[model samples]
Target: MVAITNTTSLTFLKDELDATLSQAESALEVFSEDTSRSGELKVCAEAFHQVRGICQILELPAAALMAEEMELVAEAIGRSVTPERMVGTLGNAIVLLGRYLEYVQLKNAAMPELLVGGINELRRSAGKPLIAESHFFRVDVTRERQPPAAPASTPRTDVTRLCRRMRHMYQVGLLGVLRGESRTSLKLVSRALARIDRLCGDAPMGRLWWVARAAVEALLADEMRLTPARKQLLSQFDRQIKRLVYEGERALESDAPLLLVKESVYLVSLATQDQGLIGEVKRAFSVRPRFTDGALQEELSLMSGAGGSVIRTVATALKEELNDIKSTLDMAAQGAADTDYGDLADTLVRLAGTLVMIGQSREAAQIRGRADQVRQWRNGEVDPEGMDFHALVDDLLMVENAVATLERRFAPADDINREVRNTRISLYQLDEARMTVVGECRAGISLTKRSLTSFIDSQGDRMHLSNVPSVLVGVSGGLMFLELDRARAILEGCRQYIEQSMLTGSGAPVREQMETLADAITSIDYYLESMEEHKPIGDAVLEVAEESLAELGYPVMRAPQPA
Candidate 1:
């Protein structure tokens, strides 16, 4: 019944998912104490409730059931039940729900034993006392399983041996569960905890030991269901065990604090119960192939077909861009209407792509950033009667020098445009402060127009109420720079459009209206810039400005006569 009818739905869902993860992470921190108990329960309950709705929309009832169990677990803990009794089970359930969502064949529904027994197991663990002190038998770890052992709050020996032993059982068991060896995995988890109980004695490790033991018992009672979530949880348990063992071994070698090892052992035994460790475990590491030599060879072979030296070929291409830049610079200095360097931004980006082909990814990234800076420089301000292009030109020259030096070329650029160099020094003296203000204002408005156009195109029909604030903010920011009051009146229409889009699942149904307002703003920008430059607005721009200004209920636009 919860249908994602539009693109905005997924965006909203991702936001909700982000919030749930955040709350769960917070609950993980203080879920242990009675003091933070109520607060933790509230966050967990809210997250679970949100997750339930998402799962329902995706038709994942099993995942939903898992979330519901956690909600109930938190409620149980709120009313005097122990946190150790419920933490592991709830953490395990979250892992399962995540796996269910990442599904190959998402099911309509299924009531599994794991879901049914989770709450019951928590109640049973919460009611059970610390094991009797006499159960701390010194049995060999290889021996078969035994019944419940006694517990005590007394640490008698070093936990090193126990940590090493736990390391093995937890890892092997974690692997076993992943490969569907459920009984063996549960048995190993149980064995590891038993060893912890024997070694930890009366220390805080016993409480964590019980938490671990309870987790194993819960799985055994529910038959250790082979869900992806269960496997992931066990994997996390395995990683923590490995960390615990490694830390123990180092501690033993360095004669470090034995308490450190005991603390680690306790945490390992508790696994996902701690939240932060579980988060680390959830971060899957991967190896993505990058620019290996073979890839570089392939690129070399392709570009080599252009016939000249590779460095020369690349340099030649770069020089061509410089030539075009010089002309744009001249036009900018002359205050030409067509002095936009949007093409220059595109050129630099394309040049960076060529660097990528040569396995110069680092350089490519740097070049791309430099390209972005070009737009950033032009963002709020533009240089009309363009100021000196020396800084931009020098940056390009440095790239050429680095490349030529790497290639061991001694000769300088044979084709470097000296015509650009001839008057470049004199050009920087132009007092274009007034020209800059007018040009920048026009360029800012123009860029904003393009931004709106791009937004409407990309959002398609999935726009929602949430998107309006971004647009309104952007509009206000740009127009405020120019003292335009029209931005406020137009905002009401934006609000109405957002409300309607939510109902109809159509983004900005009155897009033309928005576009017209943008055009009007741009026309005003162009008119002001032309006036400041001591030139007449062209008839083409004047007529469009006249119509747009009148449409937006602004003052009439009369074309300024030639000076």
Candidate 2:
């Protein structure tokens, strides 16, 4: 749910913000001429409402409040006494709207005192006054809880659909148990818990809250101490939750605690069973198959690295400066230098921080000192001292050139980075693969302890060995390309351990093998994290890993050993 919804919502949100800003600016322009475009003001109000709705759903209070304030100004255009007096105030509101959009995009923007004073003056003229000198950062948070009138955003899937949908999870659970598919059954229960967490998180319902709390704690539990067997049982917590679902049906029906948790996943088996549940409840439980063995993190790391992460850090800092410089450029082209310095102050702080991150503390300190020079200017637009644009403009140009140079320097190379990317993807695929292998290995080991070893396959303890794709060959090249030597070493050892201990026939007791695989994955994950964080990896660590593997009987290492 989170995966699909956030991706789509963010895109939709950016579009709405852009459209709303356009509408507000157009309305302001129309009103600036004669202050008599009541119809245009209404259109702007509708646009503001649209952006406000999407921001509310995203739980971004600051952006939503800015939209609300704009809506109020538009709503007052024709209705207020002396409506002609509010054009300048409305123009300030539109600019503030633009600043808020930038803030939402990268989270470093701040409201200028000019914008604040303008909004407060608008509030006074409209007879809808605000608190004097309200702090922009804290204002929206206090007011976000009060629900506004139904907003003008796109239509959404109703939260009221959860009751009938949750009823469907019960039958899915029963089917999973009947088929002896323990993992499937567990994920089924997990999907239910996700729903409850989304809908009834911290609700007053006693049983429902109890179920939510237990599932959350279990999901967040450390995987180091638990064997695969115990980890498999985490899904069973859903069985105890069945009763709570039934009792809480009334709460779901009444829409007492409304919410949208995540994206809906289709239930394939139920749809095929002629219960016609395929379309009905499939999306009700989108299971992401949480693997505690760090495969998920490895997959995520494919996109993460100092190359990409640091670039984002640099881009975000430079973006504000880019915006301000563009603003100054526009004003200078128009022969209007009397503008505001607040954005310049913010940009300097951001650049200093970015410089510090990139190991240029001296450059950062110089920029921080230069911020005092900038303060003598008006809103960072023009110098108040004899119009000294030459020195300030030169410094700005130097920073711009620095941004361009860093982008070219730190940008990832295609050949090696491709290997890093693919390796991460393959590792994610290996997460479920490893989970299946562990399940099969555990099933086989359980058989030696039982009399009916042959009957296990029919009982849903399926042996999943013959065609399981080996992670070693698939990702080894990529790992090597990334210079994740320690991870590559551990992965090679894991490949050998699987072949020797578990793959020839029906296999052996795999407690040691599963532990080994888990340990190898953990070590590799640490190495991957270190690389992403741009931290130095010690020379001794891979040596220690090799020694550990040799002790475990796998003749493997990422690099050659001494003769």
Candidate 3:
């Protein structure tokens, strides 16, 4: 009678399981080039025999039964392994082993539908040319499988301890490679691999091989190698090892591994006669979600980082440019012909237009139309009767000068702060243009209003007003209103700038300046509106005008109107 101690039997069973898995993988590798059905069947027979031995010793009746079925198929193929019959039998054997391993790990007797479907697919491909024109190989099964039930649970704990020890050893070996101790590390890995092979035998050797390959590649990656063939071989080894790691890692997951195993089985069925499994393997792992139009758009929007700050930055710049254009118009209204300033104004407008074009806004199209009009005026295209040519010319010249100054400030590409400085300069030019526009508009508003009032009084309220008076009034009012709108827009823009600056801890000075300008514009708008509505004529107008002048820090008193 053979006496089997619990500890000894458990150790032997664990070792057998490892040996079986390693042998199974090795058999697959060896048979990968065996085009003959008989050769492939023989390979399967050897693999199943190993699995059956492990299962029977471990007392896993279910696994043993599955192995028996696989053995039968292998035997059948061994008799007269025709391409069609051998492919089907081999594919089925792979699927059965994979499923049995998965079931053992998960302890779920009910096979997964995917597993069943995969088996069916392999069976369907039997006796046909490999569907994917690739061969099949197996990975280590026991390294990823659950331990057999033990009364004391000691064996289970030991298995976990051993796996963890191996993982740590592998990690250290990689560190050795990083430190340029390749030969030492390789020796250490070889010893570790040998120990694992001894402990688990041939079954779990695939895992050891993977760990060894990874260690070798890590060392090779840092080496200065001159041989092309050596480099190519190392590269291939690196890719294969990494792929194996990925698959093995995923297989550790109870459900995920089962799915992969099933897919692999199906692939083997279809491509058993082929010499490579690259295409089939890639297709199996390349599953991705199908995106709808809305989903795609949402994804794109997310990619763009579409948000309030981006919108405001663009809007603020645009508003500033429009204000600059208004400032030029104000100068024109005053009969001022500062063409140098005009060029700067035009350039600012163009830059603003460009920013608007890039920003996400429904109003972008309208701004674009206005930009076209500005462009036409700059190019001597249309002379609309009331269009302010002097202002337009001044704006163009000022814009050009501003752009030239920016061009000078921009450093070469190699400059460390070139991009940052360029953005700053562009922003500074924009700020200057904005302030100039606001200042001119503020000064010209009073003058234009006064001139209009004088003309109205000279003609009297009853004097036949031409259609042009309303048009002029409308244009003047429109310009004033537009300037006010721009100011408000700038105020909103400033808020965004301040928030962003606070978050990023940079650009504080620019943000502060914007906030101050925004506050000043708000005050100006309040005073101006009061004057326009409640006091369009005499003392009331004078009172509000004084308040507005004070707000603007202008000490000059209003000229008394003729009674």
Best by TM-score: 2
Better TM-score candidate (2, 3): 2
Error of 1 at 256 (Å): 21
**Candidate 1 vs 3: which has more lDDT:** 1
Candidate 1 colliding pairs, count: 8
Any idea what lDDT model 2 has?
Answer: 0.46
Q: How far off is residue 176 in model 1, in Å? A: 1.6
| Candidate 3 lDDT, 1-563, residue by residue in tens | 01223334545455555556556555655554564434645656777787777767755544565566556655654454354455455555564555445444443222222223233344343332212211122333223322221122123223333344334333344344343334433333333333332333223323333333332333333332212222333333333334334444332222323323332233222221222222323233342222222332343343233555544454456556657766766554565544344365456456655645554233334334445555544433334345455444444444434443333343211111113333224444543454454444455444433443443455433222223233333333443443443233333332333234322344223321322223333333333332222211112212222332333333233335569
Q: Write the per-residue lDDT of candidate 2 for residues 6-107, one digit (tens) a residue.
A: 544555667767777787778767866756556787887888788788767866555566667768877877776776666667666666556545544442
Candidate 1 global lDDT: 0.47
User: What TM-score, computed on C-alpha atoms, does each candidate reach?
Assistant: 0.21, 0.25, 0.20
lDDT of 1 by residue, 421-529 (tens): 3323322222244345445555555554565566567664343234544554555554454434333334333334434543355445454345445444444444454
Q: Candidate 1: give the clashing pairs.
A: 96-229, 131-151, 132-150, 132-151, 135-150, 152-202, 153-202, 154-202
Candidates 1 and 3 compared: the better one by TM-score is: 1
Model 2: ten consecutive residues of lowest lDDT = 258-267
Q: Flag regions of model 2 displaced more than 4 Å.
A: 1-319, 322-463, 466-469, 529-548, 558-563
